[model samples]
Target: MNLSLFDQFMSPTMMGIPLILLAMSIPLLLFPTPTNRWLNNRLTTLQTWFLSVFTKQLMLPLNIKGHKWALSLASLMVFLITMNLLGLLPYTFTPTTQLSMNLGLAVPFWLATVLIGLRNQPTAALGHLLPEGTPTLLIPILIIIETISLFIRPLALGVRLTANLTAGHLLIQLISTAVFVLLPLMPVTAIFTAMVLFLLTLLEIAVAMIQAYVFILLLSLYLQENT
Candidate 1:
């Protein structure tokens, strides 16, 4: 069987990032000024809470750079999230579900934090990576563990987003097909299928918001800690 166009687009890593970039860049290009400070404020609050959670209940940065960075990041995050949710519609592809696409979006921020730490405070960066407050004998173990965990953040972020979208889409497809198959035998099954599709559509909306929040929260936490 020939693969559909949807499958081809969904398979590409480069497919999703451009859409997200376009979604993000449009507003910035159209409205250069901060016409709506409400969004900015909301994003800042999210960043604060997110950082606090990851930093063992420690305070997070509310500095200019932090807010500015979050503002920029939030725009991208919103776009990616919208695109992901939109894909749940009939005949649409979820781009973030691709490893290449999510990694492209995630790695830049991950590397940016690294650069920020290295440029501003090399010692802190080293400490952040190697860590301290461990027994001498456990230092090596801690280093290996922390290093693996640190590197895995971006991979985990990408995989989680991709996997969630993939699973959701697959469920929708499977449920629809199952309903279609059983519809010939039972009309009530068709009705139930329709209900499921409706419910799943709503759930997809929540999934979009949740995926966006998770991605942004993790990114903010990473930046807050590294910087």
Candidate 2:
């Protein structure tokens, strides 16, 4: 019998190759491609419309330099949303649930934004470490604290995504297992539990989408600060 509840989070392999790569690629395939014709299919049209609206909203606060990231950020947003939703399916693995995977994504983007700030406006970027009108005695302590907070951004990004996804999945699993075990012993209680599980599943679906959005949103906010 499988004793560990965390086994489901393990990366699966096939023929000595990891399936996480396959899972990541699957979302790209699901996107509808644009046609050469002036008029496109409903699906393609809908996709275009959604993307335009999302891009507009996301880039609203950004300046011209920051707008350059519109396509990259929007693409990442879709990719993440698709992956998170796909992982909700039974028997599918969520790469985002892995702390390492989340960190891999968070660190590079976070670093890029920081670098942009440092390169474009060195004074402004370093100025963030110590605010204006600070007392002389507390200046050093505040700078140290601010520096620590600045470095913590990427770690916060990764942990937030990983912890939210992991918790949701674990809760679903525990509730599902309870449903199965209680069905034979207490049919009434099991029915109520199953109903709760159904509601939780819907909530998880929303969580998956929201977490993806939150991840990108925070990155954009960080970019906004630097740009």
Candidate 3:
């Protein structure tokens, strides 16, 4: 079935992308030259890294200076997550349901994880993927599994987001359609359809938050693994 007139106005990828870009831009705007300023600020390597991560300063809290990197990232996450949940409203479109949006969100995180891991430990990071005590024959198999898991993190992020949003929307549409068709047969079916739609709308709100949490959790785990 065709989407309603309002739904036709919404593009799945458009909303999420701008938010992603907005999030990325925060760091750049605050720290025009993050590498240099960040390096100058600290003696420890970890501190230097953290400084670099926060080069883009977006906020200044009392005496504390805020970095653009942290601000933008937080803003994007909040905005996108909020938007995602909002889309669960009867006819609102969630941009995150699109593949481009999902990829836009996932790719940078994946690349960042790879870069950090390689930078931190070089060959050791690569070698770490293999089990230390495994037999030589088993090393290859284990490495293969590890490699797959590493790659799957991003893949999972994209798929989980797109699938959940898309499926939820489609389900609502299908159920609404069934209700419309059945209404002619019996008035009671129409009421049931209305109730289900209302209930599902509420469920979508929960799903949006759940998916956002899952995305952030995965991102955190990736960072933890690299660190």
Candidate 4:
């Protein structure tokens, strides 16, 4: 019934309707909803604590102007981490694994940062393209290189998230298939393989969290230069 291992990454469809929206919505539901009360319960307390810590650490380096982005950046971080960790579950889709989706998320925010820099400090932004003490021979080359790197930021963000998630999913699938095939003929080997798979799964979970952190951290860094 299966065609290729990569098929796991394909968007699921039924009756010609893609379920990507449905998939993307699932993680939102998993998040705990807060209540308006003076005294919060344990779960809400824990969630609040975690978010406070994360946001504080994330925004510590930014200035007052950049502090305006705290809420947006925090929400983005939560959404990304949830999507990633949820995708690691069996039979769940990873929206972040799609390069199109990742790019959609990347480009707008990145462009916004650039536009902010252009609006607030155009001279500094343009100045970044040319160094103060550049040789005549290398000016053209340096400008071209800087231009290319500036344009590459969004592409890099999208590709980094996609490749990391895709690779982890593929590896887990491959090892799982190998374990299933070997179980009957080689029980000992299969058991060892399963142990390895267990460890890898743990590693993948960390990677899921780390990639989300790194993605937003890079965005914050970009925002830093502009703000």
Candidate 5:
């Protein structure tokens, strides 16, 4: 039963082709393309407005060098939100639930920020490992600990996203199963469970959006530190 519950996280393949590829591509199509016109449709306008607002907020703390990441970060935010929300639907897979997928997204961006720091300001970057006034004896130990912490950033990013989505999905599934089981035996109890399920669904939706924003936000912070 436990294994079956987790089977949903596995990548689904049909005729030897992974459907996750299709799932990822579908969100791109869902977005409306901008038209070269004075006035655009409401959806496009809303999307543009949201993108502008998000970009502005994200780039606000970043330096000029970090500003270059605005578009990429904005696009990633939209993509992640779409993918997460889509996964909540019936018969859909959430790729972000997979550790490999989340790590794939996290590592490159995190590495880029680290590389930027190393390239542009090596001393400052390396200095993060040690405090301004460290006891001489503790310096090596502090450097080792800080080095480990620095390497763990990407892992934390990936695990945070994967764990939240996985836990939410698992809870939803468990409650939904209970709802069905209790429906005939205890209608009132089932109804209450259904209400809870409805509320949980709403919370999960918020989590879906927030987690994506958080993922991007943390990357931006990392970039800010580097820049």
Candidate 6:
């Protein structure tokens, strides 16, 4: 029996130990640790430069208060980027592709930001429920709508990451299957399709990295509002 295309998305297990945990650990292996020497090797230097640049750009929007989250936010960025890039590799699992795991990552941080806003700035946080100068007739309705939207933020965050990755993976698989089926019977069509598959792979590489960045950037925005 042939396995379903989505079987690839399932968490692979060995003796009941999920490999997702191991997949998550792989990105850290890519980074080179700094040495005491004054001059670092080319790879280390490049890694340092890339991370510093990302941190600088990411932090530029926030005030001094939000800078406190530099470490957490930066670490989240690395974690996400690593997971996404790793998922693109053969026989690798993308943990973020799972809705539960995505929500697990999203809800806590999203709630923390909301709580920070509520605890530190009650009036401002509450004020977000309804804008100033609203007509008396619409006040209750507006508040209800805003409240629903507020609670949906975490759900949106989780679903967005999962859906994008899942769709990209599915499309890649469908095209690949077609390429194999058509190779002998329709050589010209298969060749054209193969080109498209190659281009899509490149695009998927970009999507993986970008979806990771988008996730962290949105979280930073939420934190910025709270701080």
Winning model by lDDT: 5
Clashing residue pairs in candidate 3 (N, C-alpha, C atoms within 3 angstroms): 27-56, 27-68, 27-69, 30-57, 56-67, 56-68, 56-69, 57-67, 57-68, 58-68
Off by over 4 Å in 1: 1-61
Top TM-score: which candidate number? 5
Task: List the global CA lDDT of all models.
Answer: 0.70, 0.92, 0.65, 0.92, 0.95, 0.89
Instruction: Select the stronger candidate by TM-score from 1 and 2.
Output: 2
lDDT (10s digit) by residue, model 2, range 8-80: 7899999988899898899999988888999999999999998899999999998989999999899989998
Report residue 83 deviation for candidate 6 (angstroms): 1.2
Q: Per-prediction TM-score, please?
A: 0.73, 0.97, 0.67, 0.96, 0.98, 0.95
**What are the per-residue Cα lDDT tens digits for candidate 1 across 1-227?**
12442363443236444454443344344323434455555555665565446343222454445555755665676567667765666655566777887898898888888788788778887786565578899888888888888889889988988888777777677677778888888989788887998798788789977887788778887777666
Q: Could you give candidate 3's per-residue lDDT for residues 58-138 as a string of tens digits?
A: 222212221223544554555556668656655455667777778888889777867876887668668768867899888
**Superposition error at 134 for model 5 (Å):** 1.2
**Which residue pairs collide in model 4, if any?**
none
Candidate 4: tens digits of C-alpha lDDT, residues 1-227? 24588888889898999999998888778777887888888887887898899989988998888888889888888899999998998888888999999999999999999999999999998888999999999999999999999999999999999999999998899999999999999999999999999999999999999999999999999999888
Which ten residues in a row are the worst by lDDT in model 5? 17-26
Comparing 1 and 6 on lDDT, the stronger one: 6
- The Cα RMSD of model 3 versus the native structure comes to 10.6
Instruction: Estimate the TM-score for candidate 4.
Output: 0.96
After superposition on all CA atoms, what RMSD does each candidate show versus the true structure? Answer: 6.4, 1.3, 10.6, 1.4, 0.7, 1.5
Candidate 2 Cα deviation (angstroms), residue 140: 1.0
Better of 1 and 3 by lDDT: 1
Please list the residue runs of candidate 5 whose C-alpha ends up more than 4 Å from where it truly belongs after superposition: none
